[model samples]
Target: MAGGEETRKSTDSLAQESSIIDTFAPEARFECPICLAWLRDPVVTACGHRFCRGCIYSWLEREHACPVDNMKLDVEKDIFPDNFTRREISQQKARCPYIVRGCIEELSPLDVESHMIICKFRPPELPENEKLRCQFVDVGCTDKFEDEPELQRHLESEVTKHLSLLSQAYTKITISNQASTSAIAQQANFWDPPAKNEQVSTSEADEGVNALLRAMYEKIVVLEQKSREQDIIISNMSEQINSLNLSMSKMQLRHCNGCYLWYINDFKNKIKDMQKDHHLMFYSPGFYTSANGYKLCVRLNLSPRDPNYIAILIHMMKTEHDNTLEWPFSGRLSITVIHPIESYRNIKETMMTRPELEAFKRPVQDLNPRGFGYTEFVLVEDLKIQEFMRNNTLVIKVQAQPV
Candidate 1:
């Protein structure tokens, strides 16, 4: 009879403990689709279905999608519903699902979101500024920045404003220097005579006066020569300034896609007489065909912009066709003027391949295309003429040529 009573007492204690546990634990709405275990903390998808946090995360990892409907679950953007009220449930509660996997703690549904986001077990964020972050975060920038506003400022800073600031600063310094020079010249008393002028005897005066007169005459001659040189320099500079102004005022639209062609033309026409004809051309004529059958031909527009030796157009080519093309073989075509040609007669002969030749062709445009231009050019190598064509947009560089 005593052993029977002991057994009944033990059974009653076990039932009471079970009841306490049931009271403290949160009621689960669904099972984790992945682990087939009771859901600990549930997350709601944009599509309004609930799933275990771990199950949803695993699904996203496999193929960025919701478990039930395959809707895109941008893990970063998905909203995790709050379980703040679940924390108020009694202490005899069940442990979090993650507890068995070494996360030995319980978290309210509300706190689970914060924990999951910063969870070390979770995938490490790709060093921030990753395209996977927020929608506004995935810009074309390869470099990672700390925040959005900083990146925005960087993109907004265009080359034009940078150039303008530099130009303005240069102008400011030039004006300040000129002002200082004018002030010094105005302050100088050039006519002041020395006290020694009153102390000389008649003969000494005559000899000294004659010497002084000769010295003054020599000084006058030197000053006049210097003045003439200064005038010549000023005239040359003025003429250059006027020519530059004229060039700037004459805004032109060039059909030739070669950005450097006009510059080469200016070298040949305006500065040709100043160059030496004996110099050799650096780049020889060549042709290149893209994967899409767009052929490009390059040749010497052999000329210089000044009296010195330098090829005005480093690479110049014209294409034979226009329209859509893939990249590497696509994007904007540009000619990099490696050397500033100062004179027309200096030329250097060089050899190039077909693709290399095409890489430097001028862009072309379709007149119907809202913003573009067209160009046609030929390659002349070894006295042989080959035709090439392209229709790409022209982006004329209007900024002052850099020194």
Candidate 2:
């Protein structure tokens, strides 16, 4: 009976595969359904369909969709250029043969073969004058100029800004080193506590002041050595923990259905780092609600408007299933900042999607231009939420579902 069930399942999968194969032609990817020929200036619809530009215009004039699927297709809102398909078809047929040899040119398929014969061979590398970047790029100067004169002019004009960036970088390094030293000092304090002088005054007098000082000095030396050893061990342990955290971020702890948990490591340090680079953002790994469901990830950063709070935003990323998903997403998002030690103390915030707002609209770019979320999710120094972080790590859980 088990063997029969397995055979039936295998047979069902093969039948479905065969049906899909029948729906597409040998080179159906490049062929338009209406024109019965290779595609020319193709445009894709949000219905997970595409057509030649000329054919789509003709079809949309008569009805709102292609004759085959009849699914709704709007020219103004739903249609977009399929850049992948465009590049694939263009390069395969019209690209110059010497592009690999550094010939930066493309021609129509009819004229490509003849043009290749006359094209000159270009050197592998371009001249330095053709491309350049600021020398202070290491310290975070991201500016572009048209030419050498423009770059020189920018350098002359922005002397103060560049010097300030260098100073900030140096200051950050100093603070980081000092923080590490203070942490070691705290550990040493934990291991050694002073004797209660009130009760032991007479006992210390019997030992003599000079002799007692020598003993105390010797003990301090031993404790310092021991602290150094412990610091090395802790440094190694921190590296291992960092590697594990990276793995967890890339591939979550387990498969999720419609919820995701993001771990923000070194929370306090991140809050400090935000002061140096206001645009710095932390993105959680991407996840989906279900199979062929909405793809999303959380964007977190110190609130731009008010640095006292952190901003949490959700973005709708482009996926293969994007064209088929509902637009102006109607759902309720339940976001929670989980307490590391106590479950009951978790901070939960809820927001429902507003159809009138652009934040929940279908994505046009790789990630939607508009993100839906709270600007000030929580206060940075709230006493009740201080315990939400453990071992300097903060955890956030986000759940999305239809309203």
Worst 10 residues of 2 by lDDT: 189-198
Q: What is the C-alpha lDDT of each candidate?
A: 0.38, 0.66
Give the C-alpha miss distance for residue 287 in model 2, angstroms. 1.0
Q: Quick one: best lDDT, which candidate?
A: 2
Q: How well does candidate 2 match the true structure, expressed as C-alpha RMSD? A: 37.6
Error (Å) of candidate 2 at residue 6 is 86
Steric collisions counted per model: 28, 0
Q: TM-score each candidate.
A: 0.17, 0.37
Candidate 1's displacement at residue 221, Å, is 7.5
For candidate 1, give the lDDT of residue 223.
Answer: 100
User: Model 2 misses residue 394 by how many Å?
Assistant: 0.3
Superposition error at 147 for model 1 (Å) = 99
